[model samples]
Target: MKSTVEQLSPTRVRLSVEVPFDELEPDFDRAYKQLAQQINIPGFRRGKAPAKLIEARVGRDAVLSQVVNDALPGKYSEAVTEGGVKALGQPEIDVTKLEYGETFEFTAEVDVRPEIALPAYGDVAVTVDALTVTDEDVEEQLKGLRERFGTLKGVERAVENGDFVTIDLSATVNGEDVEDAKTTGLSHEVGNGQLIDGLDEALVGVKSGETKEFTTTLLAGADAGQEAVVSVTVGSVKERELPEVDDEFAQLASEFDTVDELKADLRERVEQSKKMNQASEIRDNVLEKLLELTEIPVPEKVVQAQADEQIHEVVHQLNHDDDLLAKALEAQGTTREEFESQARESAEKQVRVQLLLDAIADAEDVSVDQGELQEHILFQAQRYGMNPGEFIQQVQQANQLPSLFQEVRRGKGLANVVLEAEVTDSDGNAVDTKAIFEPEGDEADDAEADAAAESDADAESK
Candidate 1:
C-alpha cells in the first residue's frame, strides 16, 4: 500500500492511494465471511460456505465491490494519517482503479486546515474603557436594594410606571377571538414593555376596572404576524412603597446594621462590577485586534457546516415549522434573505476565530489538564442548570468531549495572549489584568467565587 498528497489549494488537498492485491486479503476475507452468512448453499450450512463457493455464486465483481465498500473508510483514514493531512470535513472519495489480481486505487479530496502566520503576542495592544465607579452608580444600586424590600399597597389612582397591575387580556384578529392570546389576572409592571407592543403606552393612564384597546401584531401562535385588536382590563393597581434608607431599613435588608455601612458596601460592589466589565472589554478588544492583525483562510465546508448548524438550531426552536420561522423573522423585523446573510457572516467569523485560536494553541503548545477541563465542565453545567454528572454523561454520549477540550485549549491560548499583550484603560493607565484574567489558581478561584457571589447579589437586587 502507498499514498501521496496533492495540494489543490491552501485549504484543500487530494490524497491518491493504491493498495496491491496482496494487501487486501484481510478486507476480502471479512467481505467473504459477511457474504457467506447471508447466502444459502446446497451442501453447506449457513455461515459455513467457503469463500470460493460464495464468490462463485455471487460473482467476483460482487465480492470485490463489497470489499471495496467495506475498506474505503479505513483506507482513507490511513492515507490521511500517512499524509499528515488535517482534514476539516468528510472526504469525497472516487475509485480510480479496481482489478481482481492487480491494484485498487482511489482518490480522496478534502478540506484541510490552512497554514497561519501568527503575530508576536507581546506586540499586540488594546485599550478598554476606564473603570470608574461613581456616586450615581452606588445610588442606583441602593435604589434597587430598597425596591427589593419595598411593599406593594393598594392604590386608587391610574396606572403609573413602577406600579404593579393585575390585568385581563384578550385579542381578536379579523373580529375572531384568538384563544391562545387570552389570559386573566396576569401580573405586569407597567413600564417593563416585556409583553406585547403598545401595551405599556395603553396602560399608562388606565385606572382600575378601565378597559384599554390597542392594535398589535401577534408574534407567535396561529395568528402570528397578523394585526390584532387587544383589549386589556385593569383588574387592580398597586404601587410599591419603598422602605426608607435608614438604619432600621438597612438591618431589615442586609446583614449590615447601619445605612452607612450598606452604602459603603454597595459602593465597593459597584467598583468590582465596573472592573469586571473592564476585563470583559479588554478580552473582546484584544481578540478583535488579534483578528485584525492575522490573516486566516477559513475552509468553505466548515463554514457551511456551521451555518447549517445555526439554521438547524433556529428551526428546532421553531419546532421545524417554516411558517413559524417566517413569523419569527417578521416579528424581529428581518427577512429570510437578511437572516441567511447574517447567519453566513456569523459562521465565517466563527470559523476564522476557531482556526486562528487552534493555530495559536498549537504554536504555544497549550494543553488542557484534567483539572482545567473539569472546571470548565462544572462551569458549563452550572450555566445550563444541569448537574455535573448528568452534563458529563450527555457530553460523552454526544461525543463532544474532544470539542470541549479544544474549547478549553483555545480559551487558555487567548488568556496567554491577554497576559502578554499590552493592555491599557482609556485614561492611559496600565490595566491590572492579573486579578481578572490570570490563569487558574487559589487566588483565581477566590476571585471567581467573589464574582459569582456578587453576580447572584446583583440578580437578587433585580
Candidate 2:
C-alpha cells in the first residue's frame, strides 16, 4: 500500500491511496471463498465449486463488490495511519481503479485537525475564584435534595408560591376549542416555571375548585410565540414539608451519626464542588485570554458550520425563554440572524482554541488513554442521563469516535499546558492551585455508577 496527501485547506485534505494487486489479492480470494460456500451452482455441492468456474458463474462483479466493501475501510484507514493524518471526521472515498488484476486506487477527502501555533502560554495573570462555599450554598443544596425526598402536606388555604397544585386545564386558540389541549391531575409548583407562563401567577391566591383564566403563549410548535387563553381549575393545593436539618435527620438521610458531622460533610462537599466549578471557569477565562493573543485565518466554511451549531443550541435554550431570548438579542445589539452570527464567532473562537491546542498536543505528544476515554464518556453520559455504552455507541454510529478522542486529548493537553503556565489570579496574585486541581472523588465515581444504572433504566424504558 502507498499513500500521499494533498493540502486542500488548512482544515481539509485530499488523500490519494493505492493498494497494489498483490496486497489486495488475499481479500479478493477470501471474498471469493466466502461467496462460493453460500452460492449454488449446477453439478457441484455448496462450497465445492471451483474458483474460476464460480467466478464465471457468478461473475467477477459480484465477487469484486463484496471484496471492495471489506477492503476499502481497512485500506483507507491504513493509508491515513501511514500518512500520519489526524483527521476530524469520516472520509469520502472514490475508487478510481479496482479491476480483478489491477491495483486499487482511491482518493479520500476529509477534515483534518488544524494546526495552531502557541502564543506566549506561560505566566499570565488571571483571577481564579477562591474556594468559598458559604453556609447558604450548603443549605440550598440540602434543601433541594430534601425537596426531592420531601413529603407533601395538604393545605386548606389559597395556592401560594412554593405550594404544589394539582389542576385540570384546557386552552383554546381564538375560541376554536383545541381538542388536544387538555390535561388533568397535572401537578404544578407555583413559580417553578414549568408549564405555561402567567400560569403560576394566576394560580396565586386561588383556592381549591376555583377556576381562573389567563393568556399565555403556547410553549410548543408553530404556535409557540402566539398567545392563547388558558383555563385552569385548582383541584387541590399542598405545601411541601422538609425534614429537619438536625442530627436525627442526618441519621435518616445517611450514615452520619450526628447533625454536626453531617453539616461538616455537606459543607466539605459543597466547597469541593464550588472549587471545581471555579477551576472550570478559570480555564475558560485563561483560554479566552490566550485566544486574544493568538491570530489565525478563519475559514468561512468553518465559521458557518460553527455558527449553525451555536444557532441551534441558542434556539434550543431560548426556545422556551421568550423574555430572555429577546433581552439577549437586545443586549447583543443583534437580531436572530445577527445573534447566530455572533454564535458563529464564538464557535470560531473555540475552533481557534482547539487548533492551538492540537498543535501543542502534537508537539508535546498528548494522547488520551482508553481509561480516560471511558471516564469521559461515562461522565458525559451521566450528564445527559444516558448509559455509557449507549453514549459510546451513539458516538461511534455518528462516526465521531476519533473526534471524541481528539476532544479528550485536547482537554488533557490543555490542562497539562496550563500546569506549565505561569498563571495568577485576576488580582495579579500567584495561585496555589494544588487543592483546586485535585480530582473530586468517590461521589463522582458513584455518579458514574449511577450512570450505568441509568443506562439500564433508559434501555428498559425504550
TM-score of each: 0.93, 0.69
Clashing pairs in 1: none
lDDT at position 50, candidate 1: 93
lDDT of 2 by residue, 1-462 (tens): 889999888778899988888887788778878987988988988988888988898888888878888999998888889888877656778988878778879999988876666675675446676566788988887887678768999999999999998999998888866666689999888998878778989999999999999987765543444568999999989999998777788888878998788778889889877765666666655566666676654555666677677677766786657666765565445576676666766767666666765676777797666776677677778778998889888988999777667666666555654555566655667665444444378544333333322322222122
Query: RMSDs, each prediction?
Result: 4.1, 7.4
| Tens-place lDDT digits, model 1, residues 1-462 | 899999998899999999988888999989988988999999999999999899999999999998889889999999999999999988999999998988999999999999999999888999989888888999999999988988999999999988999999999999999999999999999898899999999999999999999999998887788889999999999999998899999999889999999999999999988877876576667777888999998889888988888889988988999888898789778988898888888888887877877898898898767776777778778877999999999999999889777777776677778778899888999986775766467647433433332332222122
> What's model 2's TM-score?
0.69
| Lowest summed lDDT window (length 10), candidate 1 | 453-462
lDDT of each: 0.85, 0.73
Give the per-residue Cα lDDT of candidate 1 at 88. Answer: 93
- Candidate with top TM-score is 1
